[model samples]
Target: MSLRALLVLVLLPLSGCVPRIEVAAPKEPITINMNVKIEHEIHIKVDKDVEALLKNQSGLF
Candidate 1:
């Protein structure tokens, strides 16, 4: 075989592996605002407080 023919066969397969790539940037700016405000309040009222109820054992189960 000739030197030119051997060189062409070894290099031809390598050309198919290279790929073209492209990249693009966004046109508008990105902004995020998360101002979170959380509030929790618990109010409880019971009739005949605990002292009066414990004094009388009639309601005891």
Candidate 2:
């Protein structure tokens, strides 16, 4: 009979409606293509005595 009661009764049904959300994966699988080129260089330094040993073509190498 009151205005507040009437408003509550009118809006009560609207509160029952909840939004539904769905998440689905794609039918086709995902593919990742990597065309990568890697280049590297190494530098070694030795003492003068070891360098002389290697230059002499010792069997150590």
> Candidate 2: TM-score?
0.59
Residue 7 deviation, candidate 2, in Å? 5.4
Say which candidate scores most in TM-score.
Answer: 2
Compare the candidates by lDDT and give the number of the best one. Answer: 2
CA lDDT scores, all candidates in order: 0.83, 0.93
Cα lDDT for residue 14, candidate 1: 93
Q: Report model 1's TM-score to 2 decimal places.
A: 0.37
Least well predicted 10-residue stretch by lDDT in candidate 1:
44-53
For residues 1-61, write the lDDT of model 1, one tens digit per residue. 9999999999999989999797978789878899999999998656777656866876776
Single out the weakest 10-residue window by summed lDDT for candidate 2: 52-61
At residue 28, what lDDT does model 1 achieve?
91
* Segments of candidate 1 deviating more than 4 angstroms: 25-61
